[model samples]
Target: MKHKSLAIPYVGWMALFVVAPLILVVVYAFTTREGGFTLDNFSNMVQYAGVFGRSFLLAFLATLVCILLGYPLALLLAREQSRLRGMAMLLIMLPMWMNFLLRTYSWVFLLERNGFFNTLLETVGLPKLDIIGTPAAVVLGMVYNFLPFMVLPIFSVIEKIDPRVIEAAQDLGANSAQVFRRVIFPLSLPGVLSGVTMVFIPSVSTFVISRLLGGGMNLLLGDLIEMQFLGSAYNPHLGSAISLVMMVIVLVSMGLMNRFGEGEGEAVLL
Candidate 1:
């Protein structure tokens, strides 16, 4: 009875915030301003398919980059001694301690035409790179912001692995490459999947990064949805429709990750 009672507050919180908001989104998505049922909002979403595609593409690239960079770094961190590991983890998390918006905006100054990198290039007589207000900038921003999400989960998984397993593999005549390929890589799938989900979902749905870094030239699914509700359009119904579609995509992605990660155990999101 006590345990059951303890869940009451959490259930109530979910009902009030999560469930209620979802229900409202559904209602807004499927109903007309006059309160009549309709499907026009969803049907209209097809017109913005290109924006959705671009969002997914950018997110995919960013997640791939993070994995490529983070996997090796996670391995190094996982193998570090306790004190060194703690310091490395702190450095990885340092950027996250700042306001998300502030961190994103800082990139603007670094990548702008007259920004630090460009100035350095000019000083060195190298051609200046025009990266700000471009898709490359959006991808860079996403990777910078979300790379830790990829590293931490994989690091946690790798660190938790029993050292005995590696010794056993070596005793059985397995080489370093074979041990990693057959054991470490397979065992780490859950963490990799979790990191992919963590990075991909937010990257796909981000509007602020695209808006600020891409100078509004890159229109993602998130930007489209925001425009419907908060931009000149002011159409909540369409916005809700887009939100529902995004939710479906995210759920599908999570389902795929869960399927692949089965038998490896659940991945720690943090």
Candidate 2:
């Protein structure tokens, strides 16, 4: 009872910071220009559906990229023992130690017209690709930043798996590919869902990646929200509406993952 009482302050802090902000968003989503509660904010989201659609598409692609890059890295890390896994974790997380903006700006430095990547292509007599200020750059930034998030959860799931399960399958005449297909892959679904969720929500809401890396275009809902909040439009109500739409999408996505992605053997890969 005493320990529970001591933990009340921590719980209160969580409510103040996390719960309060979320409640505010929900409340503001229903607020009107006349400062009355209404569904107009949500209705206003119809005007910006194009932007939200594009943002979800971008986030989905970015999460896919993270899965492609992170899954193998996670598998490699999972194969390692205690000390080696710790070292690999540190290496994977080293980039995250830097500020997110700084890391994103580093991509700007690398993807600029005359950046090192282009310079190297020039030296090799290859055509320099234009990537910055495009959706590609936004995807790059999202993948780079969220890859660690993808890896950690998948690695956790992969590492927790019993090695004997795979060995048992092999003894039953299963090959490496079969062992993975029937055994290891299913066990890793929870982690995959977790990684995708982690990557998608932030990538969808990140104006910075689009602004700094995507060269400030009409490629995402985040940019639209920023314009609504800070630009000439300056309708907090509409911005809140758009934010609420995003929140719904995120919630639905998470719910789907939770419902279908809880068990490894339950993944229905079409």
Candidate 3:
């Protein structure tokens, strides 16, 4: 009875801090100016359908890039001895402890018109390419920020995998590629799914990275939501509607991953 009594206040605190804001957003999504509940906000989301697709595409591209870049990096680090592996992991994690906004702004300094990349090209007598104000820049920023997400998950899985499994395959006359294809790759699927989940959600909602890297009028759903809340529009309901849609998309992806991951299709992505 005492234990249950002690838990009551903590439950109340969770309700106040966590559940309350979610309830408010749900209320905003359903509420209408007429003081009645309606799906008008959701209907407005359908009216702006193209924006949703653009956001989804940008996020997909960013996730793909992170997987491509981070998987090999994780593998390389995992191949090292324990001390070196610890150092490499620290190098990846150290940047995350810094302010995210500061890191985003640093990209602005690195990719702006007169920034280091452009200046380097000029110095090399090569044509200066414009990265800022482009979707490519958005992908670069997203990959840079989210690469750690992919690396860490895969690294954890790799570390747990017994090296003897690979050795056994090799002893049985399986070559490097064959051993990896039959054993290592299958074992690493959980890590890949975890990495995908980590990268996808953040890439979709991250606003500052896209804004700083993708200067000018390149649109992203997160920026649109921010504009709705803070700019002249000031429509909380619309922002909530977009937020709900993004949440649904992410949830659906997770559902699909789970179904495929544990099923016969496990051989494919797992």
TM-score versus the correct structure, for each prediction:
0.96, 0.90, 0.90
Count of backbone clashes, every candidate in sequence: 0, 1, 1
lDDT of 3 by residue, 77-159 (tens): 87777798888888999989988888878888888899998999999999987888788988888888888989998887877
lDDT (Cα, tens digit) per residue for candidate 1, span 93-115? 99999999999999999999999
Every candidate's lDDT: 0.91, 0.84, 0.81
Tens-place lDDT per residue, model 2, 48-151, is 77887879889999999999999998988898777988888889989989999999999999999999799999999999979989988889899999899899
Error of 1 at 38 (Å): 0.8
Q: After superposition, how far is residue 243 of candidate 2 from its true place, in Å?
A: 1.2
Candidate 3 residues lying further than 4 Å off, grouped into runs, are: 1-13, 263-270
Question: Which regions of candidate 2 are displaced past 4 Å?
Answer: 81-87, 262-270
Candidate 2 similarity to native, TM-score: 0.90
Stretches of model 1 off by over 4 angstroms after superposition: 268-270
- Backbone clash total, candidate 3: 1
lDDT of model 2, residue 67: 94
lDDT: the better of candidates 1 and 2: 1
